[model samples]
Target chain A: MGFRSLKTKLLLAASLLVISSGVALSLLVSDQYSKSLIDSARHQAENLALSLAIESADKVLTHDLVALQKSLDHQMKSNRSLAYLFVVRDGQVLAHTFQKNFPQELLDANTVISEDGGNEQTIVSTTGERFIDIARPIFQGKAGLLRLGISEKSLERQVDELRMKMGLITLFILLTAIAGSLFLVKRITGPLGELARSVENIKQGSWDVKIRVSGRDEVTILAKSLINMAARLKHYTQRLENQKLELERAHNQTRIFCEIVRELGTV
Target chain B: MLFSITSIKPIAIFRVSLIIITALSNIGCSDHEQSKVVNFSNTITLEKPDTKQRGDKQLRVAIGAMVSPRESISIYQELLDYLGEKLGKEIVLEQRKTYSEINELLGKSEVDFAFVCSGPYVVGKEKYGLELLAAPEVNGSHFYNAYLIVNKDSRFNTIEDLRSKTFALTDPDSNTGKLAPIGWLKKIGEKPETFFGSLIYTYSHDNSILAVSRGFVDGASVDGLIWAYFNKTNPDLTSNTRVILKSENYGTPPVVATRQMSKSMKEAIKRALLGMRDDKRGAEILDRLMINRFVPAKDDWYNSIRDVIESAGVSMEPQDGLSKSEN
Candidate 1:
């Protein structure tokens, strides 16, 4: 391809850089936010699970199943993020807040109580939705364990919001960069455009062609130099035309004198 | 550059369109409905051990709750203070509504000592090795009975007349409120649950009395000493209640310490309690508690209460509360 205009090259380079950086920034921010969102959700889930475990221990010890069920129902009602809560004893579910029987998979005695009661795991519900399960051992199995399930729906919403915000920010920066780049390209290309027009006028035999670009930059200086060179070329062409006219007149005089001298010799 | 403004002009639209596309894609994601997760039990927070050692590690003690925390604190405040002064350790008092809770607390060695009923003492000793520290001598009496009470307006005169009517019991681990009734039921060739229309657990002996007086229940079983003390000092709450039946005398509750207590600490507490009758401050505390002195604890003193529990044929069996479904 023919060489692209200076303005086109500069504009493409600046735009590419700005757009790529914005995209990169948006991706970085989105990743960081998703991670923090998950971490925050997990932290909250762990805390809530531990709370449920300790609170239900006494009721389980006293065999207050009705009270335990009532309190569990209340907690579930109050907090929508909670998916399920249960108290397990002797490898059996003593009480649970699930509408159905306890999940049989969770009934496996393999529930490992993580240190700090943060034993969390991701589970897929029968409906295929993702959830976080937090299991806390109740006083070393003196009674049972308290298990809580937190839905990922809230975390999904948070991540979406973060992504939207990041998108808006990137767009704002990209738009601003594009607008500023147009103004800068115009500043450099405006004078160059004027210089090209002046050079065209000189080629078309207008000797008084002058470029009037108003700037102190290199483009304006190039315009000024082009105007000076055009003026000198016009002056030299007028002098050469005068000299050719004079030489034609001198040759005609010499021819007429030779014709008169031949007529005198014949007489 | 200005000549082909239109060719390059569409890029503005393209750039805006790309931004719009990105923004829309991000904003398109919305919160969706989640599946319902059923929960079964209440959640409680687990507290971790503090890295910073407590400046004043208290010798925690739980007092008997035949009375309210206020009254129990009053009755044992001076004695606990005297014990604390003698032991040279800060005293922390805890109280639970049920003897079962206290028993478990002592069983788990969460507290140093507990003033609990004779029934709890024996049961805990059998289960958790609880040791008797000392027994309080109230009016020079080391024994008391279970009082079966009814509202004053009731026409029933004896335990036999309360047939098929609702009755309240205190803690399952209570001697006067639970074991005595069970023993009486056993002697009459009846079951406690079937004898009463419904057996309600009031959790505390005082709560049982309140339940009966408030007409929430037809009758209740409580400690005779607690009822007598209330009958004298707190007439308003007990004016409508009367003891309809009383069981054979049994030993009063003893100040028992968990087996985990150090020998020196136990001896220091025993010495402080036994010497309370000699000190002016201690004597004043004893007078307020309505006790003459504290005598040494004996496992034999509670043998009669154990006999009552054994006679009642009470079985503390662990069971799954939920009934399984069989197809």
Candidate 2:
């Protein structure tokens, strides 16, 4: 039973190690991937803002509102990661791709005005959608400013997918590791389990217990050594039993002689 | 002995299991704390504009629509503030869609002074006695050129290749944008309406460059200085367009004032502009605008512009009250 429980403990230890390491590895992988994806997303947003700034420079300088609106609309349609975009000059909005009224709050949401060149920031909209607001200056803020809101939803979705995949992989690894550990534990403890049972029977005075040893490992050698010890113990016990019977017979004779001597003396 | 051994083994196993459980739980807790510590809030430092009280007199300075109004404001705001500080008066910036309107404001003395294109300076000088106050010295020269450009991918090698193709021109009152191109076409014995399939007035040199770059037009004539500036500052757009021809250099645009302004005010304003490069803040502003310094303007520098307009047979007529949309 003790050996059986030892196998259980060994299996438990193996499982704990596998579970902990697997989870840690999966978490680490997913976290790194998430960070990289977000960084690339930011880079993409910055590039898009710069391109838009270049395109909008001419439109803004000429006050070509129609062409500016067309460009903004076309960009919105082409880039799905774009949530919204707009051009602002001298505190006046030139054009925007919003379907409804442009949000007044967004104007102050990002503090990087055109004079600061290009920069990005994470912002949450009134609708609770997250975005990276990127700003690029047109003509060094002389012509106007172009602002793009790159949605984080797609990045989040991608990270979630990676996490899910990592989770599944970790689970598969854990299960496989556990199965392997179980088989290993059984192989290591099989002989020891039989030895334990034989010792238990010997303790109960059953010396005829058969010990079958197998393998070239230390366990097999240990079982062979225990078999020798059990045989020697059985022989010693048989000899001791015969000596005890003789001693009893001698005691009976001594008692009878003592009684006969006492009677003769009395006569 | 067996009881003790079995008891000790189970205890040892139990202790190891407990340690693992504790270590895993610790890992989980640390992960939670680390995640909680990650902050996503973003902010920046923005300088607030000054709101100081000003004197009763305000100097209304009109900036011509050479670039966009917003751009003009940003490029000139610091310089205007510097001038206002020197003059001890508040400066109010005014903008108009056409260069002629700004000229009219200067002509009427409605504005204290104005920035006008070389062509408008020529016309305003003839029409309204608009006196030159100062001119920006770019690369140590008070002159700029007209650039005839096409999309880099286009096979057009010269102005002749643009025949029967859409062409973009800047403002009608622009020297490099209009008269120079017209003079080039005249030299080739062609007229704008007859030589090109279509023509568009982009109202600004940057816009004209963009038109050509985006393939909205087959070719365009723009200010060489603006093209060079964009090429240096923003190559993404300028790189898409190739300059095929560069016209002879003409006088750069000059800051002019009406004849009615007192001589002392003009002298003081000219001194302020000429001395800008020596001042820390003013020099920084000039550097940002790619200007070397402000120099004294001579009427002779603009004679080439007058010659181009005359030779091209282009009218110096100011389309008064015309908005950008009409162009």
Candidate 3:
């Protein structure tokens, strides 16, 4: 049964596989890298908050809240990326450094800061930008919480740069894959296209047409086999025609002989 | 050809699967290897109490102010190597941006040692149990002063004239800029935020000096060490600036270790520093740092700074008491 060519289907399948796999890999790597960056940034922010808290520990213990606030604010301002800083005492925000409002959940005295050693959550700001909130307990007892946040803009920018690079690499890989598949398909099918045209020539009475075999592949073997089959069929048909002509000649002679015998007998 | 199509499908699928598996496996292996390398390099060092007995563990050291790779590559690498050799263990330097940051690192035991300014040390001493290790002597002096400066062309001649004028102070934990000025202001019965049109924290002595010199602010309080360094190196910064007042001498910034540090290790570090000025190579390094000597110091030396910090009207609580949220 005739069907769509195998070479064409294979090429299509291969191209799809390459492109899809490239996309999948790009996505996986992007996700992993982004996660790692966010995690490292959160860790850094937590360490920073811890340091600020320790530096102001005396003030916090002595109830010198003003000194603690000034020290924290001074630190947050030094690094422009830091957005908010707050120290919670007994479930209330004892001091905050940013003008923006903070989440009340962060101020709960009973809510233990997650020191789980990694980024816990990402919050979106009113502007729709994301930030990584890093919280650390200032003192194990008495003093409540010290939460620090840094806008993810910088980290996002870094991830975006990585994504762009990976995107370029993926694009290059996809293009190369397509180009390679096309070249390979053309190489395999070029001979078959030639074979089909040759068969058409034979159908149109070009008896001298012969198929050429160049390589030791299945297509080459098939081409060679088809050429042999076509040659044998042509030879067999010519022999059959010659045998019919010979039999007809013999029959005509016999008829003449019979007619001559009948005339002689009548005389 | 039609049969070949059926056969080629399975082959192609098999080859594609193999390629994908290989690619994924390679990627996974590389990721694993990279993580291993990162973990190996990031291992913290823990120091042993006995000085003569070499500890197989590592000691983690934290430093304030992030040092650029290009600027600190040689110095820090050498410092780590030197400390590792002396302690017979690995030494890591963790850089933070502020004195408070270093103090917190010490308090959390994330770092075993640090070099901190007087203000943060005073605050940390009361809170984190910080102990002094050594003090750097610059130009044969163990003391430095705070200079209150104003534009040479400005009308202000004395600290009193700064009323209703703009003022810039370095970090709140700065002994020279914030502490001394706070003490001076309180003695004169003036409040910084209320008396001045506005107050800003520059966070660095260099920035504070530049702000006043550029006339961005009417005046600024800066560290004398930074002022002298800039005057000798880059005269342009000092050319347009004049010192309006100077604070009394105070102990210079000290090299401090955490209270968790063993007495033996602390003594070793102290001995290393005090003798640093005497060692040929150590002396050269000290010279390059513009420090004339390494002197023995105690926590008491920073009491004056503690007094200033206590009097600074600024709250140590985390709150909105400072200038309106920073831009």
Which one wins on lDDT? 2
The 10-residue segment of model 3 chain A with minimum total lDDT is A109-118
Report RMSD for candidate 2.
Answer: 7.9
Docking class of 3: incorrect
Candidate 1 CAPRI-style tier: incorrect
Candidate 3: stretches off by over 4 Å: A1-267, B1-57, B65-85, B310-314, B317-321, B324-327
TM-score of each: 0.47, 0.64, 0.45
Best candidate (score: DockQ)? 2
lDDT of each: 0.74, 0.79, 0.69
> TM-score: which is higher, 1 or 2?
2
lDDT (Cα, tens digit) per residue for candidate 3, span A1-267: 132575667566776676557655765676678678877877778779778756655455434567777888798779887877777664456678745544444333123444333223455544566666655666442345676777879877887787788778878877797788888989888888877877887788665556667889988987887687678767887798899899899999999999999999999
> For model 1, how does the per-residue alpha-carbon lDDT over B33-74 read when each residue is reduced to its tens digit?
333332223333322212223235578888655665455654
Q: Once model 2 is optimally superposed onto the true structure by TM-score, how far is the C-alpha of residue B307 displaced, in angstroms? A: 8.1
Worst 10 residues of 3 chain B by lDDT: B32-41
Ranking by TM-score: 2, 1, 3
Tell me the tens digit of each residue's lDDT in model 1 across A50-109: 777777765665455777789899999998988888777655577777675445665442
